[model samples]
Target chain A: MLKAIWDNIKGLYSLLVGLSITGRYLVSPRKTIHYPRQVVDDEILASFRGPLELTRGRKEPGQTRCISCQMCVRACPGHCLTVIKGDAKAPSRWIYDFSLCCLCGACVEACPAGALAFSHKVYLVATSREELKLDLLADLKARTEKEAPPKNE
Target chain B: MDLSLAIFVQIIVAVLLIIGLMVGNAVVMVYMERKVAGFIQRRPGPYEVGPWGTLQAVCDSMKLLAKQVFLPGNVDFILYYLAPILAFLPVLLLFLPVPFGPILTPLHINEGIVLILAFAGLGVLSNLLAGWSSNNKYSLLGAGRAVAQTVAYEIPMILALLAVVLQSGSMDLAKIVGQQGQYPWQWNIALQPLAFFIYLVSLVGETNRAPFDLPEAESELTAGFHTEYSGMGFALFFLSEYANMLLVSFVCASFFLGGYKGPFLDGIWWTFIKAYLIMFFIVWIRWTFPRVRFDQLLNINWKWLLPLGLLNLWLTAVLVKFLV
Candidate 1:
């Protein structure tokens, strides 16, 4: 009975400790990252993996790193990657179904040509399921076209 | 001030002011509760409505008011309608006895503690009606739980108040407030710590707040007794809940924390600061603790609170008799 009373007193002491902790937090600077008004720094977002896109050859301008290899297409467990091998060395049309993509990085790891990489630059926001079916080759061509800079001139 | 007509006009004005304050308190508390909850969870709460979401409560009130008054099939029309009004009305009466500032008390009467306790008890009837009239099993269970919880917690609350009452040798709440000194050491809380402890527990349980919110257990009861109520019906119950928080804080401030009494500048502002501090702690505790089980809730009141209250009362009586 004496021990029980002692334990009860200890409980009261602990309760005060809890109160003190909350009091500290009440005055401490708020840890909230208020979205829309303030965005997270890209330095902190560097490690964030979003969706898969074909990587362009760093050395060779206007050329992709893909050699029309079907390693990624065969290895994708989610069957999200579709590579239509065009006439030799021509820019192939790649259709990526983001709806089925599990984001497991299996396709990226299986790529022998080092053609695929993840980028969070364009965070996917689509209104419809059909919109999630991204025409990657067309997007790659557009990007290359934009980067190619005034061929007609 | 002695003129009868003047007294009547004063009473009317006081009533209108209290009514207006009641609604205004609900809006402020709704906003504050969300902001506090958000801060505790490490997120910004309700920042879009008006600068830092200050007008979020106003927008929410408008939304609730604008919604349809939907009544589910086979509900008792009269009882269903009366429940929210009944829950709200008696609380207004509970505000009367306590002194706000020195000259700021709207209504003053002797036997103030008894009047407040009696009206506070009437809240249970509204819970019963709300539960029964809804024609839902879950609502009935929630009402039953609420009724049981309130009935149990009220004993300790009264005992705590009674302990303070014995120390003061008066039932008048204003007189009780008058007895305490402006300094921290001279307050009734310093005199009777155990009683204050009991009052804090009972206040939380009696108010049906978290850690004891079995009745309104969202996961189990699906909004509990207010499940069937929509539009203004839900709004009234919600308003009362916040108003009840203010009322309980007022009681705590008056009875224990020295109402309207402070160092240097002594006025209504001290009372408000003290009351809001108590409220801030309550909100903090709610976020910190999880809800207790129904059986655990009852066990807490019956096994722990009641006996401890009785012991505290006995000790207070003995101390007051011999020492005072």
Candidate 2:
């Protein structure tokens, strides 16, 4: 009986120890970055894989490196890609259904022209299913224009 | 009992003020508990609602007020409706006798401690009523647990307080506070450390705060007794809960920690400081500890706290008889 009482006393002491540990953490700096007010580190954002976009051509930033190979369309497990071959080797339409994307990086690997890469669009929000059907050619053009030098001032 | 016009007016005003105090205490405690929990978990809790989430509790109370009062089918309507009111109103009565300051007590009853202790038990009746009348199996189970736990824990709490009453030689709360010295070492806690520890344990158990929150055990019982309540019905329970915590913390301050009497000052602020410190400790432990099993909770009360409290009471009685 005496030993049991002593054991409980020791158990109560351990409870105090637990309180002290949490007390330290209560005053410690918060780990969260307020999302709207601040974003995470550049390194983490760079490493993040969001939706896929067509890689820019080495010579002309506006031109697509895709050669209508259909390797990416074939490799995509979700069947989210639509590439209609045009007059030349370049594709006329590059439709990417983002809703069906599993973000598995299979399409990025199978591209022979190295024309597909993951974009860092962490705050991507789609209100409806129809809005998720992204026209990658138009997206690439918008991005190219945004990155281009200002027209001769 | 001379019923003077002035005394009657004071009573009415005090009741209204106590209601305001209970609501204000609920708001402050909600902010403190959430902020403390957030800090412990390394996150900024409730930041978007107002400046540093100060008005978060206000917004939440507004939401609860605006919510639909849902009545589940087959409930005993009268008792189901009565439970939340029963839980809340008795607590205001409990606050009356608490020596908030030397001069600040709402009522000056000679048997103040008795009044507080007696009415404190009424909270459990509401829990039982809410549980039984709700017609939900989880609510019934929760109410059953609440009844048993409250009944079991009250013994040790009474014994602990009785030990202090023995030492102070008064059942009157203000008189008890007057007996203690202002400093920490001069408090009743220094004289009867065992009783203080017992009271602290039972205070948590009595308040039904975690890890003693088995009645509202979210994992097992799904909000327990208040499972069927919504809108203002739920809000009343929440208000009474924080009010009850504030009440017991005041009792602890008065009994053990030298209520309204502290180092450097002898004012109402001392009582507020001591009571809020106890509330902070309660919030601290709620985040720190896991809920004990029902059997374990009972065993702690019956085997450990009850026995210790009785021993402490016996020792106090012996010392008071011969030494004092």
Candidate 3:
């Protein structure tokens, strides 16, 4: 009975010790990100796997190196892509649905023309089902015109 | 009629005070838990918002309120809807009998200790209802664990309380506190140290805190009984959890720490400070310890706490007769 009482006192002492240790940190700096209000830094963003984007080359102009070999279509596991061959008058358009794209970068790897590449831009993904579809030809034209590297000797 | 009106007004004020304390403690505890966890992990928790993340809880409550409620088709509509309220109501009711301080005493019931225990037990029933009503197997398992664990721990807890009653010769918390004021060394903790230790362990288990948190084991049970609940329903469960933590800590203070007794102040402020100090300890233990396995949790209660508590009771009885 005496031993049991002693053990109980020991337990209380240990609990008090634990409490003191934690009480010290009650006023310490907290390591929580107030997300949505403050965006994560680029280094942190690079570590996290977010949405993927298509890339453009510095030297190539008015040209996407895509050979239309259908390798990306074959490689796609989600089967979210549709490719229609371009006639002589119409520019080739690849309709890529962001809804179906897993952001796996398989299409970027399979493109032999170097026309397809992943971009660093993230956070454009839409929540609505209809907004996820991307018009590849329109996107490509815009990319070539807007994001093309600056011309210099 | 005039006397009845006075009683009515008193009741309203009491209820409001309990609600205000619950809300304030829940908000403070949420921030404190995060900050403690971050510091323990050697990182800064939330500094960017309103002077060292004090507004984090307010923002979180807003976010939870803004979230859309999602109800699945297969759920039992009424029970599914009622579960969060069931989980919340008992904790609020439990607070009615808790005396914050001698002067700040809100409601004084004759059997206040029993009232506290009764309402505390109701929390387990809420967990059971939440789990079984969700129509999910994991919920069922979680609820089963909750019932079993409550049964095991409550025995030791009650036994510990019985020791306190023996020492103070009263179950009325106000009287118990009054008794402690007679002497400097007469605090129940000093006389009934074993009971205090048992009560502390049982308090942790009773609150379903870490090392005893099988009811809502996220890794295995996926939010446990409240898995299917969302929006306001989820928020209510969250509120009740912190309320229950506050309730246990308050009880601990009342029984052992000389409820509301301070070196100089000797009033409600002392009670509030001691209660929050106990709450800080509870939160600290929660973040520091990894959860115990379901079987081990029950084993600690049944094979250890129950027997030790019984032995403590017998010892207390003999000591009170001879020593006191």
Candidate 4:
């Protein structure tokens, strides 16, 4: 009978302890970041693996680092990467159907030329299948044109 | 005595005001419960709709109102219709006997305790009817559990109340409140802590709320007695549940914390604050603890609450007779 009474007191004590713990948290700073209203910088957001993007050449800004050896196409498990063969100096047509790209980063790892990197575009929602078919060569050209503006002689 | 039209109008106005407060209470309690639960878990809860989601409850009622009333074919038609009405209707009368302020409360009766308890008892019948008429196995089981839980918990709750009644030496709620002073030291809670504790525990069980919320255990029973009710039926049950919450809080305030007596203002605001503090405690405890098992729930009421309540009552009786 004494033991039972002791156990009951212990049970009530534990309930108070639980209440105190939750009570402490009730006054604690709110952890909610207010998702839509406040967003973390895309620099931090971009670090997240959104999709694959060709790394810009260090020597020629906005130009791709790809050497056109077809290493990425061969390495891609999803067979999502399609690279048109070109000379080392010339830009190659790289069609990346993001629809099938599994984001394994195998191509990024396998590229001996260090030509691939994860895209900073995190919001990559696409409605149509065609929208997922990304033309990487056109993207590279647009970047190079924007960065390396022709000298307006 | 001749019936006066002025008195009749006053009663009508009071009744209408009380009904309006039920709607108002639902919105406030729903908002408060969600926000309290959220903060306890370190989340912001609802922050949209209006400033700090103040209008979230308003939006919820609109949504509930928009929903099609889905009554299952298997349900007993008469009982199903009646259950929702009975669930909420008694709560209207329950508020009449409460001492909200020195001059407030819709009706004043000598046997206020009797009126409150009798009406409060009707809630169980509604719960049973809701579960039984639904014709679902889970609903039937929920009703059975609710009946058992209510029956078990009510004895201790009454005994605890009896202790207070004896201490105050009156059943009139206003007189009971008058006995306790303005300060915390003079409160019934200070005087009858054990009874207060018993009442709090029994309050949780009596209301069919969390830890003791076996009847509506969402994980197991899938909305319990009101499982089949949708739209207006669901809304009425929801409203009644919240109105009951306010009712219990008011009783807790009046009985233990000294109703309407405060430092500067000796009026209804004190009652509101004390009542809400109790409500907040109930809300806090709900989020803090998991639902107790059926056996454990009954055991707490029987083995602990009942014995403690009886002891407290007998002790109070002795103290009052000899000392006071």
Best by lDDT: 2
lDDT of 1 by residue, B207-247 (tens): 89997887888989998888899999999899888888888
Clash totals for all candidate models: 0, 0, 9, 0
DockQ of 2: 0.78
**Worst 10 contiguous positions by lDDT, candidate 3 chain B:** B178-187
User: Which TM-score value belongs to model 2?
Assistant: 0.91
Once fitted onto the true fold, the runs of candidate 3 whose alpha carbons sit more than 4 angstroms away are: A1-153, B1-5, B182-184
- Comparing 2 and 3 by TM-score, which wins? 2
Of the true interface contacts, the fraction found in model 4 is 0.97
lDDT of 3 by residue, A58-109 (tens): 4555444455677778978888777666764233876777778787877767
Q: What is the interface RMSD of candidate 1, in Å?
A: 1.9
Error of 2 at B87 (Å): 0.5
User: Which of the numbered candidates is closest to the native, going by highest TM-score?
Assistant: 2
TM-score of chain B of 3: 0.95
Itemize residue pairs with steric clashes in candidate 1: none
Ordered by DockQ, highest first, the candidates read 4, 2, 1, 3
Ranking by TM-score: 2, 1, 4, 3
B259 in model 2: Cα distance from truth in Å?
Answer: 0.3
| Models, CA RMSD each | 3.7, 3.3, 6.9, 3.9
lDDT of 1 at B67: 100
Model 1 alpha-carbon drift over 4 Å, by segment = A56-62, A67-71, A74-80, A89-91, A99-106, A109-114, A126-133, A138-153, B1-9
TM-scores of chain B, in order: 0.97, 0.98, 0.95, 0.97
DockQ values, each candidate: 0.40, 0.78, 0.22, 0.78
Question: lDDT of each structure?
Answer: 0.85, 0.94, 0.78, 0.89
